[model samples]
Target: MMRFVQGKTALLVSAIMTAMLLTACDGDDGQMGSKGDSGVDGASGNNGLSALVSVTPLAVGHAQCAFGGQQIDTGLDTNSNGVLEMSEVDSNQTQTICNVTQNTLAVDLVGRYQSGVYGLSAAEIVDYHPLSQSAFVVNAQSGKVDVLDLSTLTQTAVQDEAGYSLNNIAKKTELNISVDTGLTLLGAVNSVSVSGNLLAAAVERGDALGNATQGNGIVAFYRLSESALPVYLSFVEVGALPDNVTFSPDGSVLLVAGEGEPNSAYDVDPEGSVALIAIEGGVPATTATVIDFKDFNIGGTRNSELNPLIKINGPGASVAQDLEPEYISVSADSQFAYVSLQENNAIAVIDIATATVKRIIALGLKDFGLDANKIDASDKDDAINLQAYEGVYGMYQPDTIASYRWNNTDFIVTANEGDARDYDGFSEEARAEDLNLDPNHPQFAAAQDKTQLGRLKVTTSMGDENNDGLMDKIVAYGGRSFSIWTAEGQQVFDSGSDFERITAALLAMNFNNNNDENKGDSRSDDKGPEPEALAIGQIGSHTYAFIGLERTGGFMIYDITNPFAVSFVDYVRNRNFDADFAIDTDTGEVEGDASLAGDLGPEGMKFIASQYSPTGLPLLLIGNEVSGTTVVYQLRLQ
Candidate 1:
């Protein structure tokens, strides 16, 4: 047994020594036998799984931000498909990105097109067509629409004959609204709107003397072409005196604000209405749905619902005849329209889908006694003295209204420009001193001084709440500011004395100057730096409001991103403050260096987004009624 054990051990040692010698000759024991199939391949290791990212554009009414922004999504490819699907996106990794974190928003004049003629309604309203790169200006003096080519437009600043810098733009052509149309358009073009290759012009019927008539107006459609004249299409009959016309976002509807103002004699008053024209395949209907204000008449169903603050004091006129639709702003979804009733100090809400009046919201009075709502109440004061008086309130009679969406909610912006019932038959405007005030009135002493509130224009229609012989409250004409209201007419934000304060700070030399004449403090008694034209635009991730000062000759910029916390951004005026400008009211002739006057009396404004801008930058187009010019301003970030 000992011999057998020793022989086996010796054999085992020999086998181990042989194996060791073979492994050393092959140097590392080959490669460990080729990676065996290992049963079913263990599911192929999931293709090494990848992490992915995606970016998409957010719209205006996004939940994350008021202004549009970028949405970034990131996730791991859990399914090994190499895609960050919505379902696979990691909510924790999702982010909302906006423009430059910190940037200065500004605007600079790019170009301006002048009409040579001045002191007339030569350029009242302006609208731009991106495809044609053209601006349609309401040349009321010629009763036509002047189309200016913006395709070849360069910076307005150029070398003049004397080698001095001058700004100018070329006129492309004039559209004859009277000719070629079967209807007799004897009146001037009041407004123009452009959307996708289509141009709409509001044409009213007039007498042979060019005076507005009680007949229905028309909205003429034209095809805008880049290389050809605007081809006239059919016309849709709206109510009398269509003051403003607008196209819906989807281009499927056209809204018209029928002013229906009475004649000078006040005997032929017509009912104010809103017309909704349906467009099928780009062609407007022959007739429109004229939504009247009859439901809000004195004895109508909605009469009791009307707010007491609404001014319905028109002589022998019902609510239907007194509520003039001065301007119309449609919601982003085109489902609703808000019409400004300037004379009535109210706004009519219309349901576009149903073509009916939803409600009428009366803009209440703005108390001047409050510190945030003071005004320069006297043109004869010889200085900018913004004062607040006890018992003094102002009617927010807005002129131009604009709508925008913020944080999934709707807001309406307005230029509280004010208006009065001044006619041969009736006039409600009176100077504060001219009004007979009660002895107990708080501002009676100040009302007797022309240098104080005496010269300020106030409406005699109000203030006499008890219908006594003497006045009680001193109600002024305009709020002298701009305001922001919710869709239901809840006052959210008001500029208050910002307009007057800003003008006084930046343009003290020309404070409250008039459009026709550079007379400082002349308009203070009426409407100090009347904020007439307003346009809201989106620059980067911020929404800005541009307000045009009709009296002071400039525009104001406010960052309205957080409407409740609006901040003043900037103010721009291209006018020559040193130059003396005047116009002959009777002769309609300029008596000063109109060329050096720059832009005056901004009556209409249009904002062009960067994507649709001719210069590939965001732009703002303004129509100056007094200067008869259309100025282009480029919005930028630095």
Candidate 2:
């Protein structure tokens, strides 16, 4: 709620044709501007009212604001190093930048988490390599992988991660090539991965996400050699939905994690798999061996509804669901793969070399599948989907599952849902209907009769009493409530009187944010991802969860120095909403909220912590999805 008017140094300049032709506005102070020009839906709202300042101004000192809101917001310290203040003055006439010194307020359009290298195009980049500026980002709906120049906005290259190439590469001739005629000699690929100088991705015929069908998921390769543009090569077809591709720390081998289904909605389960493409100095075959998602965590419970329904679709079709393989994080040594099975609320530990699912950890156990189920499903305008309605259709509650490492061996956070507050929700009676029992869709219209889960039944610390830092170890905070856990999964924290975790799940935060606030940790060669977990929780001295209340509640800063008793700092902004945070270790400068970039549903993100940059600052890559549009945010901490 920090509000401030930028020094529109550019608005002081001349006019743009787009803004001027809006039938000129009278100099009335209270005028709301012509009743939203009625020409095109969203066309030509850009013409400026011709302010005298320069338009492309740089961020300067922060300014304090007395009021703020949609039009003129208020509340918030404008001088925080990472904060950007915001305020909209008269249509087409407002400050574009507000850099205050108070340490709190922030600007809406400010490039806090600017678009770095976008991964899915639909989502921002997840993990990025600072050394090569190469990253892993997906344009899921497009079934495309984009390699970007984080420094530059333009895309460096796009690879097809689903084309056929990596299957059985060890014995294929197209894969075994001389040291000279590199893999890049192949056609535009499907998927790609990179490490240090070695880069690789897979290829699959037809966009895998576009269909509920299956194809030969290929693996391709490319290396940035010492020569100018040294190498661009092909790996080979690996497997179906070879979802996540990764590399060994030494850049010796390439690993691809399969999501199993090309499209979950359509239910094409082509053996959830993985593939290990040999590095002939980083060359892959025209076809690679197809392993499976099972090699990870038994590939989660198979989608029952998708079995008979999954199939192939050419183009213009609904992108299937459940096929998402949320993430694949590797240990510092690349010995283990921490794979997340978001759909089933499970995290599997896999042995990289053996391609084995070593351990499958059940997360959020105290909560039932119907606990988070939605009951409101009225097709009418503003109609709500029924909750138990999902159960009646053979569905359980779904979790977002985008958790990642915050700072320790067992510490990582995943989102339970991408958008908890997007809908109005269904009634208890309307939700109880089981989807599985009604697979025939007989009473699809008679939804009012089914029973619902009754407000996320399950109470605080209901599960994980032992607190082992594992999912099952944590206790429930009570009644479909959102709670925080220790690395060992102990229910160490829950918002007191907080509405619930179902709606407002704590989002991205560095456990170190307030921890290192007073004693900043100097980034060292041995330093790991910051451990202090950062989250979007209740603000003020309140000891309760916000759980996404309709009203704004400000962000809470926690100094988790003592895991047993984490301390709360102060409230910054309440409702830029589902806020995400990232900080530059070297500069001590921070950036957050970049939420508006991904529509309102900004959820699931990854930050790249690779080798030092030539300029010395390590890089951070981020990605998120909202309202169908996937946006990327890439920014150097400094």
Candidate 3:
């Protein structure tokens, strides 16, 4: 027995030395030695290192490992045994096998690009050029399109840290459309849409600055160059004041929303219309088919009686003139176009194939008296006191609209950023304090008091619910939340006061303020956290809607997969409220200073999925008009 034990001990020592040598070698060509039987009493012989243990997988990629009741974090399991050897523990290893999934989404501020041209409001509309890995931003005030190259962005490793830092670089090329066309472009570049090689831009033309010429708007088609610049191809005349333009999914058609706003003097109002241009063989047709609202008069008349729900009191002479198409959203199938009639507080559905009005859906007023829909109408209140009232009403005047298909059903989402016809010559906005309330009503006592009503701003055009031609109640602009409607214009879901409530909770003292990023309730009297822009994208197994607040200046992300039970994901804002405002008091124009603030007034947003993202991660691009800035964010999913 003594002789047998000595021989077994010698064999075990030789086997251990051979295993050590094999682990010392770089490659896995060395086969693991055969395991010997355990010693008596089940104890590991030779310094407690188990000789029979062998790692099933020598190389572990992004996986966890344990040895001796301790966690092994190193990427390389140097020893053939699964246990971590003391000498094999190296902190310099690049990979780590974490127990938990390390891919959790890290919402980080990756890049911010400034326009440098102060007050130009450089970012109104942004579209990504997938082939070039670039972004096209419309400089609204400068009448120029800026192209930004995103491929040059690099991530640098932080010293003595586990994560990396991205460099905020701004390299852009400004393409002035006026330089190529020789036509004086006015009212900024309202919208931009991109297809494979075609880039469409809608530029409102005017006889002079600030005066939109009647029936003079144009849609310019440009071919993207190999050098990442837009080469002007040709332009076609559309209607007056083309506010928004978009391309079909298959690039077969182009739709334009011609606002046709009336002059300040309430005279010379052109009919609001939409233009459809067919794209044949990568070229837009010379002329567009103009679709107007003359044929679909509700009462068979062209006056305000055409649509009883539309209150045309400000400057518009007729129903057709009052229906200003603020934004255009094309259906997923490219067969329908939904136009948002902002001031009219209605949505017009148009058949793209026939170029005719299908039906007009009036988005009726929202009752603020309900408990689910409370609002802080008074800016005089020190804090955000959302209370239900009996007589207050709000118009669902959506400014930006988007259509998407969920579970094979088509739905339209609107950002209810209301608008009033507040012009120099003809103004329709008045303080709530100036309006008279019904004395018999219970809220009349509170309305007569000057504290809250004096500070509240309401539109005078939409009141007089009895149709007696007398202002009986007060109606305010903007619903202050987003709404989901069916393709046929039936309300499916509404965010109610979630926008204001969530913003108040997240921003605290800085809720309901303007784009300057200050902490004040100044904007509460007008529009509370006015939701202006919306973009939707599917990331992994969830669909998200990115809502941008034009007043509060932040993003409200929601998981809209189940429209009935939508859940909030996150709220992010990048702004500097302490920035000084450069204002021209006489002209009533404010110049943006990017150095003093982050992005402001997110008027346009675009979501890029990971498959098409240049950084191999999902991205969200935001165009801030007030700050004339564009920011790119990377979404890291766990």
Which candidate number maximizes TM-score?
Answer: 1
Show model 1 residue runs off by greater than 4 Å: 1-103, 154-167, 207-211
Model 1, span 200-232: residue lDDT tens: 899888644445767788888998776888899
Give candidate 2 regions above 4 Å deviation.
1-129, 132-137, 140-148, 152-192, 202-213, 225-231, 262-268, 278-326, 364-412, 418-430, 433-604, 608-619, 624-638
Kindly list the per-residue Cα lDDT of model 2 for residues 238-270, writing each as its tens digit.
555555566755565676666554343434435
- Which lDDT tens digits does candidate 3 get at residues 264-368? 766667878999999998888999999888754446543342456766665536566777888888888888899999988899899999988887778888888
Model 1: lowest-lDDT 10 consecutive positions? 157-166
lDDT of model 3, residue 439: 61
Minimal lDDT window, size 10, model 2: 524-533
Candidate 1 local distance difference test against the native = 0.81
Question: Which wins on lDDT, candidate 1 or candidate 3?
Answer: 1
TM-scores for every predicted model: 0.82, 0.44, 0.78
Indicate which candidate wins on lDDT.
1
